[model samples]
Target: MTSTMKPSYAIGVDVGATKIAAAWVELSTGQLGPVLRIPTRRDAPGEEIVADIISLALAIELPDNPDSALLLGVGVAVPELVDLHGTIRSQWNFPLPHLLDRLEAALSVPARAESDVRVAALAEARFGAGRDCDNFVYFSLGSGMSYTLCLNGKPYSGSHGFAIHFASSELAVPAQDRSALVAAIPEDYASGLGMVRLWQERGGFPLAQGIHTLEALAAQGNACAQNVIADAAGMGGRLIAQIVNMLDPEKIILGGGLGCSTGTYRTGLETEIRAHIWEQSCTNIPLVMAGLDENAGVIGAALAAAPPG
Candidate 1:
């Protein structure tokens, strides 16, 4: 559908490494309906992944008139890299590059897709943490690390939509390991998978359990888990501070699974942010939690399809 068509409602779906979440969005008001979540078939082929998204979209009850223009399209927020045309660019996780075409054909509605982090930032800009801020950074520490720079409530995808590839940026931060200084990219230690990998490398927890198990261990007074989490948070904070230093955004909004989780990680990140900020005046910039919770991605994805005027 053309932008002039102005669909009143859209389906927003967030595709993650672990789960797929979706919701119905009212385009005019930026309000989201109840969310539907299901585990992702992480190892499945692109076809299966697309099928899952189709299933989720179809699960939401359509209007009495299925052919009505009111429910106009599907908006997807995916973990993989997406191009300006809504084609998946990276095969790192799934090979469904023609996702938009397949989705549109299957659902008989227009569809749009973008980087999950970017869409989440869009959601926050329109309806969540960044709603009142004109300039801010939306950094997510999920299964992967990436960020979207929002200016005037619109996310800047850069000249080629490759701007926010923070995980592979080669920007290293220093940390102490066994009395020796070591450094690695933020993706190696700060992301959700990175934290789990760090735990496995340290040989403290069972291989099957991931970050949540580590959080549990930390809460139970396990020193190793606590240390690993603290170290990871430090790495994340240092990296985020670099963004703040460069952009000087009005605020930094944190989101994603690891980002929004309740634990010492948040406190640890805040502490490190205060410690590493180069400019004292910028140190007080509010490091606020994402206001939309898990629904941010879906709501934002929907908004992507049916942008608010």
Candidate 2:
């Protein structure tokens, strides 16, 4: 019997600070199979991590028939600074140059790397919430915060390929002592870490609860949790509103564990965004949660490695 599977599939790897996830993407249908995740050996040498990534990609099951299935290439998404050629310049203090070279030699297939947020934006543009829009801004608010501006369905990586590093942009917030000035970045007030910091600052009960648990607690009417989340959401909204005002994107897609949740946080975020939007016409700009969720990064890597026909 003739196999119905496509002739080739792309492997996508998402390398995060805590874990590395990989999957095989069917080129013809854009379907992603089960993801294989391994705890990231962040402390290990960069070369070792690269080897792990390559091995994981090679181990993924392709189509049953050898003649019917081929490994197209590999795409990697890393939480680091990457150049246009997929070279990791620097991030997390790991030696990435050697790793990049080793990956290419070991894989024997075209390998492309990109910033994780950029890859996620690519995935959303092709298959998720941004599929119908040519221009949109993708915000990833997790342990870190980043945003990618997509124009004409392509991510705008500035001259240095660091256009999305909004976390470093300074923002003025009240000092902890309330007697002096404090300057903080968006990530300090808008990401998972920021939420936890806010909770701690506000002296929330059960201080051990993580961001997810805090969300649950907030849902249960915990005032401290609510305040922490609300503050973060509001700040996040202001940052997003700034992006909207500058780019005028048709939509703003929010991703990451905390950003995608539906409820008070999102409501508060949207409320602040609406309040800050300057243009009357921009008031209707859609602010939607990411549809692809966790798979977005890997799928995006695959899409970047092998552009759709």
Candidate 3:
């Protein structure tokens, strides 16, 4: 579908497999209100999730005056494959394509949706970490993992929109006695869930706990905890550095569970990433923690619907 130009209060919605978050911004004041979250009825079929978000907008009652001659449009972010025209080709966790027409009908405005991580690069580059540089790399390691390269104001979606997920060869390290508990190519080792798993495998817990424990240990400088973190970052950095070397982003921003944390291993990731770079100057290239955390995607979605200069 061709994107029509419109003047409206941009409504940003970051729709994930498990959760849906919406935000409203009054453009003139530049004041962004608090984000609203909706529990994604993942079990429900189709349009239900999308409908929930539109309902959320009406409920939040942003702009206050619905009759204020302001055209209402939405920028939706999904965690899947999206074409330039906002066509979703394939999706893994969340598939709410059934609500496309209904959403536009209910909002009575133009709506655009793209991959969450991809639009996140746009959002952060425009408003957060990437604000200072024209070139940079972003890796958002949520439940799933994604990499986006932003140059100028646009995200480099590559030919298939999954460019930076390049596979890595196992970096040959000297043989050491690792327990069978640790998998070779640790798939469940880098995400939040994985971190919890790592903690459990190390014989360290009652096993059922919240994120604060993860944050607390990393903050406290636990060596075993830090090792698990370093392992993930070491693996992530190798993949990220390859993208960084190719794109030559001024900064490489890390978000999601492990990336957003402050730990000895987190610092070690920067050192490990610098080690892989051919040009050692990348050592100082700045691996930054995500400033806005998870909210970046929602804010970016709002920006997408806002008027462009």
Worst window of 10 by summed lDDT in candidate 2? 92-101
Determine which window of 10 residues in candidate 3 has minimal summed lDDT: 166-175
| lDDT of prediction 2 | 0.82
Candidates 1 and 3: which is better by TM-score? 1
True-structure RMSD, every candidate: 3.9, 3.2, 5.3
lDDT of 2 by residue, 1-309 (tens): 885655668889998876789998876656897899998888888778777887887677765665677777888888888887777777653555566556668777788888999999988887888989889999988877888999877888999887777765786766878887787777777788778888877876554647778888889999888888888888888878988888888899998876787777878889999889999878988888888998999888888788667
Candidates sorted on lDDT, descending: 1, 2, 3
lDDT of 3 by residue, 16-111 (tens): 756788777654433466788877887886666666877876555565656663655777887777776677777566677655566678777778
Ranking by TM-score: 1, 2, 3
Global lDDT for candidate 1?
Answer: 0.83
Worst 10 residues of 1 by lDDT: 172-181
RMSD of 3: 5.3
Tens digits of lDDT, candidate 1, 1-309: 655654488999999888999878887777777788999887888788888888888898644454554886899998877888777788766666467887888778899988898998988998899989899999878788889999998999988786677665565334645565554576878888888888878886574668878888889998888988998888888878888888899999989887898887888988887788899999999888889977888988988886655
TM-score against native, each model? 0.90, 0.88, 0.79
Candidate achieving higher lDDT, 1 or 2: 1
Per-candidate clash tally: 0, 0, 1
The TM-score measured for candidate 2 stands at: 0.88
Give the poorly placed runs of model 2, Cα more than 4 Å off.
1-6, 43-48, 93-97, 173-181, 204-209
Give lDDT: candidate 1, residue 166: 64
